[model samples]
Target: MKLKVTGQNRGFSILVLVAACLLLLSACSSGGNGSNGAATSSQQSVANDATSGGSANEGAQSSEPVDIIWWHAMGGEMGRAVDDLVEQFNSSQEGVRVEAVFQGSYDELLNKMKASFGSNAVPAMVQMNEVSSRYMIDSGEIEPVQTFIDQEGYDLDKLEPNITGYYTFDGQLYAMPFNTSNPLLYYNKDMFAAAGLDPESPPQTFEEVYEAAKTLTKDSQTGIAIAISPWFTEQLFANQGALLVNNGNGREAPATESLLASEAGMKIMTWWKQMIDEKVALNLGRKTADTKKAFVAGQVGMIIDSTAGLKGIVDSVGNQFEVGTGFLPRPADGAPGGVVVGGGSLYILKDATAEQQQAAWEFMKFLAEPEQQAYWHIQTGYFPVTPLAYELDSVQQNMAEFPQFQTAVDQLHATTLNPATQGAVMGVFADARESVANAIEQVLTGAMEPEEALQKAAEEIQAQLERYNMTNG
Candidate 1:
């Protein structure tokens, strides 16, 4: 009997949804959406001070309470977790009160943020997606986290390096890492055992994955289900020590063009095409929800998805079949590459009073603490940004109950810090990702060969990058 699994959106799709929301918001907020000059002036002063390494709190802690707004895109259980933490922070102190506001999804939140610029309604702090790091940094409206760290002399060593690495640029931490996640190979233990494969050891390389898929594909069940997403494709490239864009994956300097038609890119596209040709891997298009559904319904034996979906998959699978997880597969060469961090980070907006910024920093520090980090990890299945959170009793107990959760942590720890692993920082990343998805779809649907599809996509992306660089410059 197959387990009836309900589908959920993960990673790349969610980012796309956010981007769409941003567009919708921009359209809605056009015309008469007025600005507050006074607020904008105050914000500019505070931001200037912060950028100049001035203290976050020049004045003493006020006798009265300070209320600040935190706009976030988290929903469902994760939303509830945010509420709980806010309540804790409010109750724990009399100096600050944090108002947790849900501004739709990450895309919507960003949209609202853009619309709120130069207005008093702008949030004091906002949760921005990881992919938006480049845009956010270039926006010139954010007070880097390093400002607070340097001013307060906070201990930055407690945070996980891999998680922090994604938000760091030019040796400065631009944002506070939050709700970090990485991709993993999720498989069915029962299916593997029945296929005469060792359930204890999952495939670690692409070649092994292909052979296992061959044996696992038998009757109605496909061996693997993977969504044609830029996130997964990015991981494949990074694992092969390949650069997605020029200028050290956009870390050393601004990226001018994509390298999707390079040798490493060809290797990935070839493997994907071969898998679908052999009927071993199901072509799920760009819908991550469909891939999740296929895996849950036992229609496919394995999937390449983010660790963020672990809780939902476990809950949906129930007692039907045991779920197993392993690090994402690498190329046959076994190159020393690593996965990039997904999920969003917290950014303290510059359009706020110094008191509000200080209060926001307090809340930020609170969230990064071990206790809060552990609670968040246990509740939402996001990796704790701090290593100490893993040592917490709650995290340890949860890990024991669901050992699958440890795979992502292990993968993150093993990942070497490099430009490829840091991921591409481009202003037109959303468009670039969409283009890559389209290219993969073209290849899978037999409309174009891998080389042709990748080449076309890379050219389009390059054009967009040039336009963006011109405008932003």
Candidate 2:
């Protein structure tokens, strides 16, 4: 539900934000041009009231449609595909018309939302990363999604439980998870074959990963590479019985404190040190893209990265060599916990009129529909948030042919809502992630032992959490 691991890509593009702002400002200033300006609340109100008062049997009588504005980050072919689906929805419903807006990256979209909050001109609906859900909910600027679910009579159980857990805070649901994914072990099948390993059977455990890496390691090359962050370390720690925070509901319970400095954590770090010493594992900078590219180019034999990297691998290795996907390794005791999902969800803005909310709800439901969710999974390589989608014939067919997609689905269903794996949730997640990333870089650079680096990271993170809890709580 949230992808805020240390070094995870933050919606960090500044230019996109600036350009969006300028475009919006220009649209606002040029009132007569109906191209890009947001709809006025008065306009939306009139439409909603008209639709509500006039339609118990709108199917019997034709009426003007409700136009809902949705701003999203999906673009390129994916954007066009979403737009096509919206068009289909428009044609299917006599009461609603959804306009899909392509905003930039998650970070850029977040900044735009902040700006809109100040101007009282936010979009009716926006897709936000799971990590930022708490802040949006705490601001009281967004509606609790449970209200809509209850009002609309939607079944809560229809969605994945782990996905629901991501958007819930203080026992209230605030977002509808649109996409969810997790890291998988992607390996060069060609390299595995050359190293006398079975390409069909990838690394099943960390011990095997080490041995396979030893075989795959070459000049100016390492056998395996990990992007240092919660993506690798947290899941690995979970496999080894380590918990970074207090055991309970993970970030859900503020009473529980962090345990990143605990014995289990120390053991995890010590093992990382050994891997480094053995020269089987190297720390590439904390970019998922860079590490993924290193693996695709055969610089590294294996990489533990998000399953979302599937597209990149397919693109880079198109007929170049064989690519293999497998579940993340377990320790001797098996996976410490279920693999936590990492992705984003959609939240409704509070200021939107009830009619707009209704319209937005339709779009949200559309996204969650079995067909659309399957399409999203097929396009983005993220897991379908709903199980029914996976049951669709098309989804099953795709899985049968692709095979790689099943790795994420299998791990996702196997995941549990444990604190050790569900991920840390505190107000200063962004800052805390930065602290962890810096500590990781320090350790990988040989400036500090993993234990010392992690200890410093724990102190810094705890301090940030204390300050955030004090202010936000």
Candidate 3:
């Protein structure tokens, strides 16, 4: 039942052209709204009405189906899965028809959404990355999911609290949890056995990981391989219960500066430098693909990555080496703080009509159903946002086939829903993340001292925060 509007070959180009037209139109219409301008009068009114207990679908039941547009960044197999779900939802309901549109990557989709803010071409629903929560909330182009939940008195008890916690700010959920994942340690079981290490007992702490890496390192195979990404740095800080920024990791109030110059951050960077210098860990630069390939090729004993990579890793390594998964290592000196969820969520745009919003909400709710969630989890290695989805027969079968997936589920259950694990919410989080990654690269490549690199990155983030707060506050 799903209609394909554009062919795969032309989809990206057409989307870019459409986005350009929208941006031009929006710019010509609005004098100086800029990209992060305040909500227009219409948007404000919509927000007010939604927050004041007004139903999105206020009109009486009509025979005409409400068509809603959904812009998502999913591509490849994930995109196909999304289309399948959209088809199912459209066929299952008579009152609503959801049109799913591919809008490139998360950054591209966000750019298009921002450009459409000044015009009326915004989608009824969009999938936004988790780190963009603050910017999305500030843009005022979104109606908080909590508003809809409160109006309908919907039951969200089935959803994972830790997954929901990331999108929750000011005691309210800003977006509906959709695709969620956490980092996990992937090791080569064959390499572990050859190194005289038990594949069943993976390292649980940073010190243990380092010791294991030393033992696993050999002539051709390095102990571990990790990409130079800020994500790993963020995870390490979270594991140590350390703040990445001030103001309770930007949950209590707008963060004014970065806190990456702290002892925990320094410790992680120092350890990373030592690992690379000692040849215990391969410096895979900034490309995750490189690290993944190295690990699958058995050139590295272990690697840390999101649980979402499990299926891909298994398929790539295929029959060559037994791949084992474990929870990401914690800090040696601190209490286990748990891993933060890294995925996108569904947001309803304010520019859409009441009926469109209602239809979008229905689609969101349908997608969150246990069956759909289980199917999504199975198709795309993303964690099921709802606990009930795990009980599904298909999900159980998948777990039986891939016991390594259970580690992710157990890790999620063990994670504490605290501020540290909730992750930092900053308007310029993407830039900040890049700055941290650059700092790590500098340290690993011996271009700069760890302290100097961290200090420079922290300063850069502080400036970005100041600039963002000036316009957003």
Per-candidate local distance difference test:
0.86, 0.73, 0.86
lDDT of 3: 0.86
Question: Which lDDT value does model 2 have at 284?
Answer: 75
Q: What does candidate 3's lDDT look like per residue over 72-123, in tens digits?
A: 9999999999999999987775666789999999999989989988576888
Local error of candidate 3 at residue 36 (angstroms): 19
232-262 per-residue lDDT for model 2 (tens digits): 6666666554566763535546623656666
- Worst 10-residue stretch by lDDT in candidate 2? 53-62
> How does each model score on TM-score?
0.87, 0.82, 0.87
What digit string (tens of lDDT, one per residue) describes model 1 on residues 1-473?
96344356456677888999999878644522122223233333343343333344443222346578999999989999999999998887666778999999777787789898777898889998999999898888888989989987988899998889899999999999988888999999999999999998999888899999999999999999889999999998888777889999999888998999998888888888899999999997788889999999999999998898898898889898999999899888856788999999999888876657777888898899999999999888899999998877899999999899989899999889888888889988888999999999999989999999999999999999999899889
- Please identify model 3 stretches exceeding 4 Å from their true place: 1-61
Residue pairs with colliding backbones in model 3 are none
**Candidate 2 stretches greater than 4 Å from native:** 1-63, 238-242, 247-252, 333-335
- Report residue 242 deviation for candidate 2 (angstroms): 4.4
Stretches > 4 Å off in candidate 1 = 1-63
